[model samples]
Target: MIKFNYPDGSHCYRALHTAHAVFRNDDGKLIARAEKADRTGMYEFEITGFELLSTGIVYD
Candidate 1:
């Protein structure tokens, strides 16, 4: 099990099951990748083309 916190105070968890397949990138390099969650629970996903929100500061 792998866990991490996002910038929006949400948590994300991923189970490393097995390498589904190996695909080649644009440079023809083999890359090992696995399938993500099955979308059964609440998960935080970071959008690529979005601006960050300024929600004050988070102090741990």
Candidate 2:
């Protein structure tokens, strides 16, 4: 699971392993993008509009 929080306190995620996060809406359309931060536990998120709403998601 890809997990990280944006600077604005919003969060985005995906189920695939990649260098960047590609956020999609409920309709599965592209909405936002962010790259993994050089620092751990953070993401440089821009183009907001996505947030993970599911509960019980954990980092592997």
Please provide, for model 2 over 1-60, each residue's C-alpha lDDT reduced to its tens digit, 9 standing for 90 to 100. Answer: 444555476665654443355566676555444444443543533443444445686543
lDDT of 1 by residue, 1-60 (tens): 434344466644345443243345576544444454664443223321222233464433
TM-score between candidate 1 and the true structure: 0.29
* Candidate 1: regions farther than 4 A off: 18-34, 38-60
Q: Worst lDDT window (10 residues) for model 2?
A: 44-53
Report lDDT (CA) for all predictions: 0.40, 0.49
Task: Quote model 2's TM-score.
Answer: 0.29
Best by TM-score: 2
- Give me the displacement of residue 40 in model 1, in angstroms: 16
Clashing pairs in 1: none
